[model samples]
Target: MQADVETPDYLRDAKAAGIGGDERWSIVDHVAANPRAGDLIVGSGGARKIRFAAPGRGKSGGYRVVTYYGEDDLPVFLLNVFKKGDRVNLSKAEINALREELSHLAREYRQGVMRYVKGR
Candidate 1:
């Protein structure tokens, strides 16, 4: 199935990482085609970390994308992106914040869906 991908923070992140044009779309396309392409981050409330290679950087030296796929019915959210060397791992506080953010996103999405269905 074709998955919907939401990029709330991706635009800024990608611009910061010097990724745009086809490179940006490629990342979104890859994630949409394989929602489970990344590894689940511990304590991230369902966020996954996926690697995308830069033009000549290759996967090992590319960017890290943090995404959340709460459920099959929900759109995948691209939370953040950064170069591999920019950050190795998130701190405890960062993980906690991420969990809370994901929780809120899921809650909001579900509520919106409910409202849409009821309206129809």
Candidate 2:
């Protein structure tokens, strides 16, 4: 697989490449709002949790992407399905980006989760 996979903003971010913040926020919130995103946060670094899904698709009915980012600074991204076949799969590149973005977001979330957890 390509190293570009799962590396966010490594090349061109969905927003910088023309995608908007509102669009990115839509999915992030939608995923967080949905149960399909699950309650399991992606990494151990953050106490705060934001969830997401990468469907490698566009406006599909079956695919829902769950992404994790900081509680405050959520990564800007949206799952765009470029093709459809017998199965659903996200690109390694996209996963990488989401991961990168999620890491940044998780930091903010972590702080909040920490504060909230500690009753600070």
Candidate 3:
């Protein structure tokens, strides 16, 4: 099934990383086609990290995207993105914070969806 991709922070991060439109769409398409394409990030509350090749750069020098696929009911959330050289790994504190944030996001999203469905 085609997955829905929500870029909550991806646009800003991609712009900051100098990622162009084509590249951005490529990433979204790939993720939508295979939401579980990335590896699971330990202690990230189900967040996954996927590496994408930049236009001319190989995967080694590409961008790393942080995504969360909490469940099939929720859209795949593009939480963060950064160049490989910018950040290699998240610190313990960072991981904990991400876990909490993701939890909140998932809860909020579900509530919002439920409200919408009821209103409809």
TM-score of every model versus the real structure: 0.88, 0.30, 0.90
Task: Tell how far residue 92 is off in model 2, in angstroms.
Answer: 1.8
Q: lDDT per residue, candidate 3, 1-120, as tens digits?
A: 556555657778889999888888888888888888798889989999999887777988999998888877878888889999898777789789999998798789889889999998
lDDT of 1 by residue, 1-120 (tens): 456655657778889889878888888898888887788899988889998887887988899999888888888788889999898677889889999988899789889889999999
> Tens digits of per-residue lDDT for model 2 on 1-120?
101112243223344434346655554455445423333433423222232333444333232233333333344223232212223444456456655655565466558768999995
Clashing residue pair totals per candidate (backbone < 3 A): 0, 27, 0
Cα-based lDDT for every prediction:
0.84, 0.39, 0.85
* CA shift of 92, model 3, Å: 1.8
Error of 2 at 61 (Å): 6.1
Displacement of residue 85 (Cα, Å) in model 2 is 5.2
Q: Where in model 3 is the C-alpha error above 4 Å?
A: none
Instruction: List residue ranges in candidate 1 displaced over 4 A.
Output: 116-120
